[model samples]
Target: MPQSKPQESPARKLLNILLLVVGTVTFLGFSFGPLFQALGPSESPEASLVTEQLRAQADGYRAVLEREPDNPIALRGLIDTQLQLNEPQGAIEPLKKLVELEPENRQLRAFLAQIQQDTGDLEGALEQLQILHEKDPKDSQVLQELADVQLALGRPSQAIELLENYLKEVPEDNDVRLRLAFIYVRNNQTEKAVALYDEMIAADPSDFAPVLGKAIALSSATDENLRAKAPELFEQAARLAPPKLREQIRQEAELSAQRNQPQAVESQETAP
Candidate 1:
């Protein structure tokens, strides 16, 4: 027997139909062009903040792009949304375009650099940061970002040179000092790291960056005496630290103490 025609539900019909109320409109000789084409919601935070209405809004923004391709507002919104959606690679072209459009806007360039950094395009990020640093050599933010990129690329010496110059100009910047000190430790200048931390501690004994940085530097010390100093410093940091970070400081102290203990090595014997 032939089966009866199946009834289509409204929801099924809706899914089968074109959604987002599409229409055609003529503008500047482009006839029957789509005014807007609604997109599906993306997982990007920039998009997610107003996700319930974002899809249609994004389409509208793109529609704006159709009319004025270089509209800074639309371009910025589109790239920001693209970034929020975690589409860093997709964001690059528009970001570059925007940077070209607003060559002097350092923040936009910084945003583009950040997108590059986030997408693992560290080289691109480094280039942008360098441009920014050259534009404003005294910009600590740019210096730190460039140093970070250098560190990520395993160019510790370059990072050291960059950060040290900035530190010389701004000796009161303990956070930068701590960062430089750690770089020093990584480059096998534990003594220099310790001295910088001592200076930081002298300025503000309660501040945690130097306290933690010094603890780490000392814990990795090959000299037994320096290694022994880590636990006491860690204890002091833990006591002065905020309650939220107190446990973390204590755990670090324990690890430092263990590193200070002498390790037993087993030597292999072979027939000569």
Candidate 2:
């Protein structure tokens, strides 16, 4: 008998694909960049014709689904047709049905969650994300996305807890760590935020992100001693920054100095 090739797991396949295509991380570690290139709607003269054809196809899929509600083929066709038509709302129903039918399919669940997020059904997205997280808590992409959804829903504490737990298991994920620090800054937990940046700097003093993050965090502090450190940190960050960002960091340093001057004089006059 001939040997059959082993099928690759979806998660492993996703990793292989991302490894081949992943690009630069954003300054704030906001994203790991695109997973796939988006194919925007066509603007050519045949655009109307394309739209008409898609609508007809969608109607056909809907008719088939009406007769055979459990037909995965019709469900998938309708989902694709709705997405290409730029009507994500229309895709949600069929996608949900498909997801229910294939509860064990990770890719399908992730796709459905993304569609829910895009269509502003954040609660729905959160539900799906929570399920994914429970299944694989250490998935960096899922962790970041789940945290993002929590923040969007005005639940910073929940986001913080999620990141903190994930970090305990995967402390080396600097991107998620950076994102957690950014969240602390936004939540006005300045000291905690700066501590995270300090840890990152201890790990890699040459890295610009923690340097810049610490500078900004301290610069906003009300304590004179804390606020006083911002200018020098900002200066260091500017030096560490690339040429394109150097001027902007330098400008921040100058502003920090100006803001701290009044407090500096007050502390000087009050000295023993």
Candidate 3:
């Protein structure tokens, strides 16, 4: 009889089957991947090309601005391009021109205020914010922005006062409460911060922002008793937090507990 063909081992058979399956999957993916990618919900190549062309035009407009520094047309072109490009700093110069050309243009002033804030000039931004706030005292956006700049400029007390006054008028504004909580934390008024956060959470359990804030404030407390309270806050935060934030809250809770431990005492001499 002819010699029997060598039998494939089970492992070899499994490996062959795996390779065949992988080859089939790869072939199918190669055939359909391009079609799916082309018709996906993302922007089309033609749309991207158009965007690039528009960006190039914006760049050209900026070039014209550089050559004719004070040309109104160039100023307008630069302003439009900079706004489109999301370059607030670049928009500032043209906005200043627009303001100079039309001193009464409140809209330009508003845009300048926003650009100033974006550029980290909190004081300058505050001046603009003050102007806006004066123009419309009930404008919550202006009040909020002003209070934020005040806090960033190391004037938490001022922010607290502003928020307090605003909250008096807009008693039901949860946003004001949130800002007040942050200011309280910055001011090292932990109890007030925790209370504000608690009130906010009572209003809306789904508001994880305040929960996280409370956890952070609790974790930062220098008192051991207070720090001990942080674990519960962290647990709450972890429950509502995203995966990355949950891990961070857990780490912070651990670190806070470690920091709360009392230092060991050294033995004293029996006789002096």
Candidate 4:
């Protein structure tokens, strides 16, 4: 039999799919960016018929909402059908009411915020997220999302403060920590970002994420001292990443050596 390869730790396994995470990070990191892409080709021949079908369905859902404004089922249907028809502007108000009715529904709040973001209603999205964050201050999910919204609005320092404060309360959450460090990197807080990555690397050497992350953080730095150490960080990650991703990691590491960082990477756990 051919020799079997060593199994990867759970953290190491996450490295195998970094392409999806890191690639989408640039596209989805900002709430101002479209949350969902057009599902199929824009010019599909059958699109006209599909559009009519969706519009009819949406009309039906709205009729129901008219009779029962707080009806979750009808409200959800209207949001879904309108979005399917590529008309999020009409869906926002109904979504807001649905969110109000179901104050405890995290999914509803997120969906509403996503539609708001998609429609260029950044201030509205911020308002909704702030309510959710305040309603449950300890919700890690809300905290990360609110941070992303802040970053997208060009308030990275606020995002850093929010995540850092949350981290102090939940020190063991590698997921949030990873997100915080990524935000730091994006904000050009190279020293702080690298230090956080070092702490992560020390806690679980099996994780190549922070090592690769440090290289990413350093890629944007102007400091000669930080830039000098980026290649070593990249090299370290390449060796530690799983075999399946080793080559890709090495390529990114090589890029980092030239101070050519790829787009920022994000934790899938906290991706909007």
Candidate of highest TM-score: 4
Work out the TM-score per prediction.
Answer: 0.72, 0.73, 0.61, 0.76
Ranking of predictions according to TM-score? 4, 2, 1, 3
Give the higher-TM-score candidate: 1 or 3: 1
For residues 1-272, what per-residue lDDT tens digits would candidate 4 score against the true structure? 00122344555433432322234234332322334433453677688788878889888988897888888888878777766766778778887887788788866777677677667776777788888888888987668768877877889888889988888888898767877877776666767878888999989887788888877777567876777777787788878876777787787666556545445887678668
Candidate 4 CA-lDDT value = 0.70
Residues 1-272 of candidate 1 have per-residue lDDT tens digits of 01122444432221111111111111110111111222445678865666645446567768998999899888777765554444456668777888999889887787777667766788988898899999999887578668867877889899999989887798887556766776688778989988998898888877765676677777887887878777777777767766766786676567557656778998989989
Q: 24 in model 3: Cα distance from truth in Å?
A: 49
193 in model 2: Cα distance from truth in Å?
0.7
Task: State, as a TM-score between 0 and 1, how close model 2 is to the true structure.
Answer: 0.73
In terms of lDDT, the best-performing candidate is 2
lDDT of 2 by residue, 6-80 (tens): 444433332222211111122221232322222357878688788888899999999999999999999988887
What's the number of clashes in each of the models? 2, 0, 0, 0
Tens digits of lDDT, candidate 3, 19-121? 2211221211110011101111237787677557657876887788678767777777766655554455777777777667766665566567666766666
lDDT of model number 2: 0.74
Positional deviation of 112 in candidate 4, in angstroms? 1.0
Clashing pairs for model 1 are 44-84, 44-85
Q: Which order, best to worst by lDDT?
A: 2, 4, 1, 3
